[model samples]
Target: MHGPDRDGELWRRSRVAVSPDGDVVGAISVLRNPSHSGRFSVSLEVRPDHRRQGIGTALIEVARGLRPEPLPLSAKAHTTDLAAMALLQAVGGRIYQQCPGRRPDPTSPEIRSWAGIQAVPSGVRLDPLNGVTADALAVAWVAQYLWSHEAWSPVTSPDTLAQRLREGLADLDPATSTGAWIGDELVATSLVLREPDGAVTLVAETIRRDQPDGVRLVAAALARCMTLLGDAAVTNVLIDGHESDLHLAPVLATLPPTPAEPLLLVEIP
Candidate 1:
C-alpha cells in the first residue's frame, strides 16, 4: 500500500497488487467523500484472470487501514454486477442508494406526449432561458439538488454547495434550457448540458414540489427543452438521476424500459 496524498480537504491514495512477474493484477483508490465528511469512496479493479484470488479484498483492507474518519467507506457497483456487489457485501457493504442512467429518445411517443402540455394544468407557462446564467437560479438549484440527494448526502456548506451547482450549471445550454414559471416565480428548470466529452445530458428539476402541478409542469418544460434541442440539430441526450427522485423518476420512466448500467451506492462499515 502507498501513502495518501493531500487533495483539497481530503487525502487520496492508490494501492496495487502485483504478481511475482511484476505485473499489476489489481488496484484500488481511496478518497474522501466530499458530500459526507469522515467517509471515504473507493474504486477497485482486478485483472480478469485474477478472479477469487483475494486481490480485491486485499485492496479494500488497505483502504480500511488508512481510514481518515470513523464513518464507513463507500463504493459504487452496478446493480447487475453481482460479483462486485457480493464482494463488497462480503466485506460488510450495504446498498444505500441507486443512480440510474439512460439515453432518452427525444422522439419517443412518451416524450412527445409531453409536447402537447404547453401549459400544464392550464396556467403554468414555459419559457426558454435564452442566455441566462446558472448563478441567476442559485436558490432553485440548491433546493432541487439538496432535495434530490437528501437520502444519502446532507448539506455540508451552503456556499460550497451553491458554488458547485453553479459550476455544473456553467455547462448549461441556455438555448435549450427552459423554465416553468407561474407568473414571475421560476418553479422549474429543464437544463441541457454538453459535457467536455461532447456528450449531452438533460436534467430537469423543480423547486415547486410543494405545489400540486410541480412535477407535471417540469415534465412539460423538459419536453419543451428537448424540442428546442431538436431544432438546434442536437441529438443523443443522456440523463442520470437518483432512482427515487419524485421529479426525475416518472419522467425517465416515460421512456421504454431497457437494460441500463444503473449503479448502486454501497457503504462498508
Candidate 2:
C-alpha cells in the first residue's frame, strides 16, 4: 500500500510502508560505512499498531535486496528491546558490541583532581583538525591505529579515512573531534559524538605506537570535549576497544567498567 513521496526524497537509502489508511507504519534506513567495504548498518522503526504485522520482516527483506553482493549488515539495539533482539537474531545478526553507557561526575573530587592534572605533556601540542595540509595523514594515522589495536574492521585507503573524518566532524554540533600532533606527526586523536538522548559517546580514540605521551593527549582532548557539552545532565560516556590494548588501560581506568559484549567477525564466502 506504500506510495511514492511527492518530493521524491522520502526514502532514498531507506524504505517506507504505508497502510491503506495512508499512515506510515514502518521505516528503516540502510546506510553504508564509507570506511568499510561490503558492510552496512540499518536503523529500523515501526509504529505500535504495525508491530504484530509482518511489516518488519517485509521491510528487512526489501532492505536486503537493495544491498550489494556479499553484504554484511549490523545494528545496535538496546539490551532490553526483546522484539528487536529477536528480529536481529532471526536475520543472522548477532550482538556485535554491548557497550556500557557511562556518565561523568563533574563534582566528584577524584574527577576534579584528574581534571587538574595536566594529562597532555608540556612539549606536545593538541588542536582541532583545521586547514592543516597534513590533515589527511593525521586522519590516516589515527584510523590505522584504531583498526590495528581496537579490532575494528580494516580501512584500506586514505580517502576512506578522510571521508570518515569529514562525516564525524560534521556530526558534532560544537565540533568535538580533535587531532594531537608531535611536531608534524599526528600521534593521537578522539571524537565525541552527542547522542539524541543527551549522552556523549566517545566514538573513536587512537594513539600512535611509539608515542608514550599519546594517552595523556587523548585524555586531555576528552576532558575538553566534556566541557564543551556543558551542564546537560550528561550520562554514560561509552567507549569500547580490544581487551588487550594496553596503551589505553590508563585511560580506561578513569571510567566505570560495564560488561563488554563480544563481537563476532564473520567473513562471508
What are the TM-scores, per candidate, against the unseen true structure?
0.87, 0.63
RMSD to the true structure for each prediction, in A, is 2.8, 6.0
Q: What number of clashing residue pairs does each candidate have, in the order they appear?
A: 0, 3
Cα lDDT, all candidates: 0.75, 0.58
In model 1, the clashing pairs are: none
Off by over 4 Å in 1: 1-4, 108-110, 117-119, 232-235
Scored against the true structure, residue 18 in model 1 reaches a CA lDDT of 97
lDDT of 1 by residue, 92-115 (tens): 888888888676556655444545
Q: What RMSD does model 1 have?
A: 2.8
